[model samples]
Target: MPVYKDKNGTWYVMTRCDDWQGQRKQKCKRGFKTKREAQDWECRFLLQQGGDLDMLFKDFYKLYEQDMKARLKQNTWEHKACVIKSKILPYFGEKSMKDIQARDVLTWQNELLRHRDKHGKPYSETYLKNLHNQLSCIFNHAVRYYDLSTNPTAKAGSIGVKNAKEMNFWTKDEYMQFSEVMMDKPISFYAFEMLYWCGIRLGELLALTTADFDFKNRKLRINKSYQRLKGQDVITEPKTKKSNRTIEMPDFLCEEMQEYFSMLYDQKPDERIFPISKSYLHHEMDRGVKATGLKRIRIHDLRHSHVSLLIELSFSAVAIADRVGHESIEITYRYAHLFPSKQAEMANRLGELKKGGGF
Candidate 1:
């Protein structure tokens, strides 16, 4: 039994109890003027208390952590935890699981829209899309187990449906200009070369140990990557099954890598091929680009340039996909420009196959 106040003054109400476990003894402070209002309010409040949204979220995460440990690979859990901490937790960590609304998610998305990276570039549409995707997964799990109102992220919708237009790749002369500027910084310069020629990721490149290179076979093994998990750097397995493939190094680059290896301070087979921090490598890359007067060229674009060159050299899509560790041909299709120009050139030769009429 509880006393409550209203415009007419105070009135008494008593909650019905069945058992100790089912009974809700909490009192409402505000007085409901009508008997129906009071009954509805009590019922809703009791339902909410029974739900215990805070406890539900905490318990859900505990189950998720356990399932992740048992079902997911170490690298997968590490990656999810990293993103959850760095990109997600700081925003929605304390939010009530059931009360979090669509607007709350939209506000967070808007904030991420204006967010910038360490390099001062605004968050890419691609990056935001990925963040939203991860958030959606988390919400989906919550909804499945915790009885949330709904997944707030599901209502946020996509930022955009279309991807940005393709970027301009470098010409042969442009690549030469880039190389000339980077001559003084051999490690950064050659690291770029390796990524371009080998078509492996920067993470994969850094994770390479000396023993992974097969000089006699002219092959480079790529099985691991340096990933940032929970703000700490760690060597982890690649993202997909295809990422474990070995690639043949170009003759010239192979020779250069051999020379680079010989110049290493530690000649141990287990030592990292490039023994520099990511920052130092990126700094050198930026410096070289600046010195070359090509500020628009990104390190990633070097990979694009390499794929473009391979297309010009007439490699098939399957071959290109294999080299680049693309899980599907759909991904390879995004880089299709490499082959089209060559195809057009080859098509021009079709005119030569026709016989010419005599005058």
Candidate 2:
């Protein structure tokens, strides 16, 4: 038997029953605003308790978080989780997994465009788009395995971002100035030198171990990268298949690496080549650049400088791509303009051909 009351304090319905053993069950629950809502809840509860809806909101969210963390790399998970904590949870934390819809996602996307962070910087189109992408990925897993009715973000499209002009790499003189600034810091100097000569990523550079090098053979192996994981830094395998490669070291760098190896001979096999934290290295580099009045340059720009120098030396695009571990030669072409002086050199070569008077 059951009893229900409306919002206005009026009774809606009452039911009673007696057991076969003549036992009376006195269950008097009230407070639903309407008879229909109470009836609907009654039916839903019965079905839900009988396992008709096995996937609860908390269960789906738990699975979503687990799958996202497992599939995404540690840095990626941390970044994406920042977005979810700051943006997604406030809106949808209490939302039912089954009731989420495309409109809800669309509204969230629109709101994100208008929202700004505590720092007052508006969200970039790329950031918004990536957040949507991560959300879609989460929902996709839920839809595929958790029995979600539909993916709320299925219709979401990329936020249209205009292409910006390519950036300029450091000129030879700029590199010299940067070099002069870093001369006193051996690790910083050698790290920058390796970037300009070896085209290794910053993370890969930090992940280097003495054993990963063969100074006598003048070769450097890149197999792992230092990535931030769970708020701590850890060494992990390269981010992509193409990210693992061996590079030939210049004679000067080979000499330096040999010295570095000799100095580290007493250290453990797993010790970091540059035992300094990334933040400390960045801080030192910034101080050096400021003291020398050098042009502003990002750490990544050192790798860009390496690729540019190779291009200026007329290294084939395929070779550069292989050296830099780019999956495609097209990506290598992005650095072609770094050797723009070749335009004039090619023009001169064309003039020489014209002197022969041939097409």
lDDT accuracy of residue 157 in candidate 2: 58
Per-prediction TM-score to the true structure, in the order listed? 0.69, 0.72
Report the lDDT of model 1 for residue 234.
Answer: 79
lDDT of 1 by residue, 233-274 (tens): 678788678888989987898898887877778577766777
Runs in model 2 deviating more than 4 A are 1-59, 117-120, 147-150, 160-168, 231-233, 329-359
TM-score, predicted candidate 2 vs. hidden true structure: 0.72
**What digit string (tens of lDDT, one per residue) describes model 2 on residues 242-262?**
888998888988997776667
List, in order, the clash count of every candidate structure. 0, 0
Every candidate's CA RMSD:
9.6, 9.3
lDDT of each: 0.70, 0.71
For candidate 2, the 10 contiguous residues with the lowest summed lDDT are: 46-55
